[model samples]
Target: MEANYVSKTAKSMQLHRRAKQVLPAGVSYFIRYFKPYPFYVDWAKGSKIRDVDGNVYTDYWMGHYTHILGHSPSRIVKAVKEQIEHGTHYGVCHELEIALAEQVVKMVPSAEMVRFSNSGTEAAMYATRLARSYTGKNKIVKFEGGWHGGYDALHLAVKPPFELLESNGITDGALRDTIVAPFNNLQETKKRINDKEIAAVIVEPVIGAGGCIPAEKEFLKGLRELCHEKDAVLIFDEIITGFRLAPGGGQQYYGVIPDITILGKILGGGFPIGGVTGRRDIMERMDPLLYERPKFSFQGGTFTANPATLTAGLEMLRNLEDGRVINNLNRHGRRVYRGLEAVFERKKVDAVVNCVGSLFQVHFTREKVRDVNAAYRADKEKLAKYHSALMDNSVFFLPAKNGAISSAHSEEDLEKLILETERFVGESGY
Candidate 1:
């Protein structure tokens, strides 16, 4: 075991050192980097990923929660391959784009008209702009710890120290119109919305990056009512929850519809994509035909609704239409949640597992984690140690991030994960 660890460490360190010469912090994305460098995956199939050192792990990250069907599924791969043979891009409108848009409109409750973007950040940014245009208001109300994307407008208040900006280079003026509210606290959110200038209330059905804390049903209903009362667009940032919670995303699962919906992640079928859909009248403000009008909200992208991504996403949605995959993944997630809870109970570890649908997170605190602040208060050191130990046992989960269950995970994979988790609990002296 020691020899294997040394070998893995050697390969990862060598690659990380080479990466640092060109890439900042030796990684492309911030979350991909961690202490002692992150594992370099050679390839992944189904629920397993092999590192450069040839060590295999049962993967739970699932491409940052995007791979609901698992890594490099045959359906998506075949579609992409066929699409590439024809041509990857044409610089013109295609039939697949319309087909994909129709599927989204049919599935999502709020989707009457759909506009596509290349990433969740672009979709969310455009959603906010559409809301402002529709309401003729400037301020947007966002919950603390609810991450929309990396855009300047909605990037505030994603984590603790809520008063400060999440990233540098964001001016105070950029955040001047962004109002932060406490998640799950309907009263506090209502108070913040009292300002008549608020244009929208954007929230995550489940806090994905902040923590896998599901929003209360009552809270979501309250926001829907308040947005209608205030004439503000309520945007459900379902980038993480879309197609994972149900066929119509969070709105269908919770029976509370938002005025505007932001979707990405799973919709891409392991590719890059984002979509903004909402009421026809509101979405019409982005119509290129209305370019001469003052209310027009400009939204365009070079790679928006590309045929390759559309073909892959369409195939994924077709597979999900039967709902068996969704049910299986959610069941697997519940099993893991219950198993983890039992381990913590028997081991006397002061921990709580927050789960909703196929997403779950382990917090090293006894308190129920309903919001970002509660999650932040959990023991970070203990959680990291547990994650690292799990990694050592050939079980891979995103360190300090949530875990996602995919249809690719077989019963054997789940059983092994539970057994390994139990072993970690027994050996970890925390």
Candidate 2:
């Protein structure tokens, strides 16, 4: 399989060789690096991406799950193009920012106010500061499998060996007040936070990077109640689940609202963006005029709230506001979940498929995956092989990462995915 991939991706291989001289690991992001080097995309449209080698594959990664409307949707492209002619970056306040923020407040149940940033990592960092400022506490609690971006306070305990630091540069003091708890197990989570001076409890409604496992509805309800009892802010890091789950995001879909919501990916309409939105009282801490320097939790960036990004974002939100597109995508997600499970079951493969709305990941294990530990215990090598097999057959999955379903994906595309999975199962001894 590796030899076959190398043969077909000669152009990509050559590009990778050149890239290694400039970019570390031949990729900008480490996650983009896969075995036998990753393919460099020449262009993408709708549900497919054409690599430099001219091999077109149905893309399930969807630009880190950002392109919910699929690549370069005509409406967003037109809006951005029109905005670009006016100005790309103002570095100052603009009506487009106000329009997008108002739209977010209208759609998100808890979003009484909104703030924007360039990426989810920046939003996570700012949100953490706001929570600490609002509550006057330093301690933050996060779930083991939850991923709230690369912010130091919430970056630990993301994967197995939960006690180890996720990265090297993080200082001990940076994580001193951050507590790690078990995901989906409210009792265990409560025990970890017992009687602590907590500022906030952050979580990913559906764990994305750690594993595509959905938090139990009951567990989320428990967290909401627990946060109230402890006077801690409840933040839902909805970077992966925000617009993709529903127009109102995971909070609306699960009927459990958080005090603050962190959003990214689909919110940008394929552009780079991150947002922090929630109750007005909590969000207002970022306002310098309302509070002095000591009380203020500052949040701003040079590229934040730029015209071009807001133009694209507003259009995307407007399309998803009615929930028709999101509902259809959810329906497709359910179908894919069932189809994939049936394929594995028919082949007597001991695999578990974890799915929530439009996001899904296949774990090569008999154990039911409820948390990150169970996910990592599965056959990692087998999962990689499965993803590679899918890629070879013109289906892309980013190799063991979660796969997303977009509105642009057709019935034929889904059918092809299932048939390819069946073929992979039949051919492989696993």
Candidate 3:
């Protein structure tokens, strides 16, 4: 043990403390904490990540659900190398953009048009704009715990404490117009839509931040019906669920299509990227030239269509050929979820494992975690203990209990995780 506010790796510890002085909260995103400090990664390959001090672990965080293919994949690296030599960002049109967009449109059934951006955050940002701009509505409906990004409108009602649902966010026109309801509660969802001004209802088909909860088949169908009847757009925030579920995203996996879909994560092949894929007419409204001041929704990025990232993304999608990666991913993901469930049973742990595709969460509570409220029943203290134990054992999962598997996670890797997890259950008598 080094100091509480210091990273285990001394050089990075110094770097992080300095970062704290210059950067708010010591890092960019609130989620990247090692908290009481951090761990500084020097490199990662395949399923393993290594820190600056030679500590290594089989990682399942998978870069917050981005690297479905793997880290430093040979094809992506090679493509990036080629693209870099050709020059990184032309800030103008290029073939890689066409290639990436074509692949998305070809694969996603709902996508007739595509626009690139820099992150899942950006994808969510523009999706709402399109929904509002095309529909000419002022209000929005979002599931409680459904997070799109930092934009103030969608930011409301996200990750609210269970007790504070009505009280979450500032009591103002922006927050008031935005409705919040529990996840998987269709009736409550409808109640919110009663507001005629609601423009879109954005949801994650398989929630990333909310315990990887998948929408029930009936629930999603009902949502689609509600959207159609109300003339409101339904947007799927597939940033976490897009390529990870299947090439066509959660829509194809669940067989419920939305009016608009925001995509990111695995699409970028480990590079920073995002996209809005939707109906041509709705998306065309985003064309600046169509508006008087050319301002339907102002959005641009210096690295919007950078060749290196797109080339890597193009190659990354290539690895999904013949359904090799997804088939294996689901098989492995189910195994991990079930194995953990069995462990909880044997250890008499009052816990449940929730999963969708390659994502899973170990909720340390007996409650059926259907919504953000249900997930809140999980024992945070116990989860922290489990996270620490896993990390100490060279098994790197999300420090907050969320986990994902990649094409690189082997049976050997998974069972190793299970065995370590068993010890956690047995010792804690959870």
| Candidate with maximal TM-score | 2
- Where model 2 places Cα greater than 4 Å from the true spot, the runs are none
Kindly list the per-residue Cα lDDT of model 1 for residues 1-430, writing each as its tens digit.
3444566678887898999999999999989987778878999999999988888998999998999999999989999999989988777888998999899998898999999899999999999999998899999999899988899999988889998668999988989898889999999887776755789999999998888999999999999988888888999999999999887888988999999999999898888999999999899989868655686898888899888888899998888866787888788888989988888898898999998988999999989999999999999987887788778888888789899989998888878877877787787765
Q: Against the true structure, what is each candidate's TM-score?
A: 0.97, 0.99, 0.94
Give one digit per residue, the lDDT tens place, for model 2 in 1-430.
9999999999999999999999999899999999899999989999999999999999999999998888889999998999999988988778988899999999999899999999999999999999999999999998887888888887898888987788999999999999999999999988888888899999999999977999999999999999999999999999999987889999999999999999998888888999999999999898989999999999998899888889999999999999999999999999999999999998899998898888999999999999999999999999999999999999999987999999999999999999999999999965
Candidate 2 vs. true structure, TM-score = 0.99
Model 3 shows how many backbone clashes?
A: 1
Is 1 or 2 the stronger prediction by lDDT? 2
Q: What is the C-alpha lDDT of each candidate?
A: 0.88, 0.92, 0.81
The list of candidate 1 runs beyond 4 A from truth reads: 1-6
Q: What is the lDDT of candidate 2?
A: 0.92
Clash list (residue pairs), candidate 1: none
For residue 309, give model 2's deviation from the true position in Å: 0.8
